[model samples]
Target chain A: MVSLRTKGSFLKLYSWLPILILYISVLNEFDFNYLNLEYFSFNFPFILIFFFTLKDFKHFDYILVFIAGLFNDTVVGLPLGISSLSYILICTATAYLRNITIRPNPVKDWFYFLFIISLINSLNYTILTLFFSFDLILMSYLVNTFFTFSFYIIFVSLFKYYLKGLND
Target chain B: MASSRDDFIIAIRSAFLKKSTQQKFSLLTLVFFSLFIIILSSLDFKVIRYSKAVINELVYRSSFIVSVPENFIKDSFIQVKDYTNFFNKYKKNISELESLKSNYVSNEITEYENRELKELINDYVSSSNKILAKIIVDHDSPFLKSIIINKGSKDNIKIGTNIYDQSYLVGRVIELNYKTSRVLLLSDLNSNVPVTIAPQNIQAIVTGSGVDSGKIKYIKSGLSGQLIDDSIVYTSGTGAIFKSGVPIGKLKFFEENSTNEYKVEFYSDFSQLKYVFAEIITQTSILPTTQESNENSVEKNNPLDAKLKILEDELNIIEESNKKFQKENENLKSEINNLNYKVLNLNNKISSQNKTIDQFNLDTDELKFLRLNLTYGHKCRKSLFNNKGFIVGSAGYKDCVLRKGKIDG
Candidate 1:
């Protein structure tokens, strides 16, 4: 009986791992920027949210994701709600993608992620520049999008391994 | 085609309106909430500002707590790197210290002179005090470079307060909360500093390139050609956003697409900064309006008083000049005394040399006379048979011997 209870608790923790990781990533800004590579950064939260929300994971609450976005903005020193908007928009896109598809393919999902991120980044650039009068480098956004798109596949594989473990 | 389009619309609406079982708010509701927040944030409402400040305070503290482990890792990495280059860095620092030490005394004097001159020029006396603050969050984000410091309005950290890393201007406080403020680093894309390029004295704007350095902008058409590598860039106090003459960075030139691009390499590395100084400036008017009015009344009542006041100012200036002149005169007097002493010593040396020369001449004459005597002794000697010369020891005999034993004809 004791062994069964312990296993159950472990399973619960494992099931909630995605949401926990989301919170940790937002708070910690877990990008390996300390390596000091030139123009080397990727939005980890974007990848995490896209994958989990598309999977429609039970524990990946949209409200928590929204809160995580707020935390990210605070950490990154951006205007409040900007990150929240971006995140919500991503969730919506993934939901729409989920609804319109009968059969899911990773390759299709990956390409769709690229399009979504590009659109979101362009929107971000426009809002910051036109509304906030911010002097932002368009090239940095482009590079960020490219790197995020590239890193999505790698992170998605790792996340898939975790999900498989949870299911088993 | 019409059915497919209808299906796509239905999918979008379902995505927007539907919420999962665990979710609290629908996607549509969250979207509207986010928009509401964005609009609220953009407005300069006092309540919204306070709310934002509270959120910032909480988030900053949480971030600082969360970042402890990462900071340790970063510090360890930096420490390891530092150890590798320890000896080289020490040697370089020693040489730089030596040069800086020589410049320090002159710099202090110039600073004092500058202070006095500024007091004379401006109507208000601005006193600045730099308070040290710890950087709570320094995430070098690629988009917006900024840091959160543990100082805020409570500590008199107002917006536009200049932050410094060891006296080198780093950035300024843009947002102030209760106990924390956000400093927009000079490397932020939004950061624009009015700087004067040294040696050339060119005025220009430095805009952050979203990198470690800043790019020079808005310079005169031909002035960019005059900028050389390592030319100093400092705040010009043109917009009064930053204090004048605060060193910002050095101008660096790099080739891009067959054209030279000038960038500012900041003196302080933003990434390595842990603590910074926030300068709080308090300005006091030099003369009160009441005093000015009293002076005006006095001048109108008696023009002589106005003349006397002018004379007093003139006297003060003259007194200051006189003190300088006195110092110069004292220096001149000491110099003159030294020169006079040197002249006396030189005269004594000349006289001694003249006496020695006279004695040498006399000795030479005696030696020549003796040689002549050896050759023509009998011809000039005065004796019982030969009485052509005077006595042997006489002056006349000595002269005649020196004259080659010849008698005056």
Candidate 2:
């Protein structure tokens, strides 16, 4: 037995499922890499959406971004938190975008979110990667994010079907 | 059955009330998504792992339901195969027996009796250390990755413990829980074995890069009479990583031109895998020369890192190949629409890759070293262009990948 508030918090955590699935699927293809823009490496937006989608993400989005970045930074196996900072900036911009964009369209909202997230993710990942400056197939990451975001949007849309029923 | 006037009154009351059903539903949906977002951002994989277990339960339950027909079909096919094989053996044995009956003198040789003598060896048992485990769930995903074993820390299974099937090296223990441990298959990306390339004291690394096949790299190719296809690639587990003189894989297709690849087909069949014995030792003394020093060992990365990388790559290919001509031909042609559609699929793939990496705690110095070489090669090219006068700006597109994964001094 849990309070509705606790349950609500718990459910918020559950949203991570879709994102986690997204992260893992991408990771499988790319691998723990920066130089190879394949599926397994964490590109910019992957980190961006990834950080934003975590639990307790509402407050201190920037801190969450850096903390999340540490995992990659630690494992990027070099000067850590470069990806974290980059990811934070992406999330920050997203929050700003969310505030500014006041259209009441969920589909449009998703598209806008995806576009901004993609741009920021790549930019951040690219900037951090310059410190190490290993050549990756930059196009590959771009394509991957583009498709990954689309898939995320589609998967997200599917949930609407069930929720619509539940609401009824 | 209610009238429009009644509906309007109910709706009015609902709107003014403390909470409306629609509002509650909206709040619930918001809460659910918010919860998901929060959970995701935490990066504490343990909870996600728990969630995955619930998902696995659903998947397994559904898979069991759906696989009923598949099993029936498979079982029928196997029955037919068994009957045919039995007939062949029985026919051959009957003929042999009949021949023996006609030819033998005093007492005809029975099928069981006309066999090799059973040599008995004395069983002298002493102190023994071993851990027992069973494969509970096969990795639902592909990639010849890792298998989840029922044994965990409770069973004394620790990371880096060697695992075996009867007499062959299968994999090493990478992750462990209280009652379950995940065995990193010898065929997983992070799995690396330091083996002595028999007959010739050639020491190299045998790493699992894919399913059905593993690569034997780092050996100086064509040193003597080495060709594309050869026989007998036995494991000389030089670095105490595995038992000496065990079979890892067989020499399969060879890249005659490239010094990098010696593709060998993996013999340790994960498909037939069921039970395993985990060796608890943390570090294998095998292959000491090339083994990574502890000081520089990278922590296990989230598999998500790997997946995101792949998506980025796919995008890059489309942009590169489709870029120049597309803008000219455009009415927003969406040249490679498939690329756009794959967004979620790519993300999903990336996420799973992250999960797998996390599951096995994937870490690779070899990969790290390889990445380092790319950086170094760029540095070297910069230095070379600067020193050798190959024209400064033109060297930007030198396009180099470090050969041999060698770490530069």
- Top-scoring candidate (TM-score): 1
Model 1 lDDT per residue over B1-409, tens place: 9999999999999999998798888898999998888888889999999989998899889989888899999999989988999999999999999999999999999999898668656646889999999999887677889999999999998999999999899999999998999999998888989999998999999988888899998999988889999999999999899999999999888999998898899999888999999999999866547866777675768756765675688789989999999999999999999999999999999999999999999999778877889997777788888766678787887777777778783
How many steric overlaps are in each model, in order?
0, 92
Per-residue lDDT over B1-409 for candidate 2, one digit per residue giving the tens place of the 0 to 100 score:
4786776555433322322221222222332343344335345477764653443333333333443454455447656766979978899999999986776653334422322111111112122256667765443222236666767677666677678876577888755456665577776555778765545556667787645456776776565355345545666756656655566666666556674346767666665566877766432222212333231133115435434544576679869878766765674556566667788699999999999887664456446545755564555344534453222234232323333322232
- The DockQ values of the predictions, listed in order, are 0.66, 0.01
Query: lDDT for model 1, on a 0 to 1 scale?
Result: 0.89
Cα lDDT tens digits for candidate 1, A1-168: 999999999999999998888877777776556677767788889999999999999999999889888888888888889999999999999999999999999999999999999999999889888998988878888889999999999999999999889888
Local error of candidate 2 at B65, Å? 16
Best by DockQ: 1
Worst 10 residues of 2 chain A by lDDT: A26-35
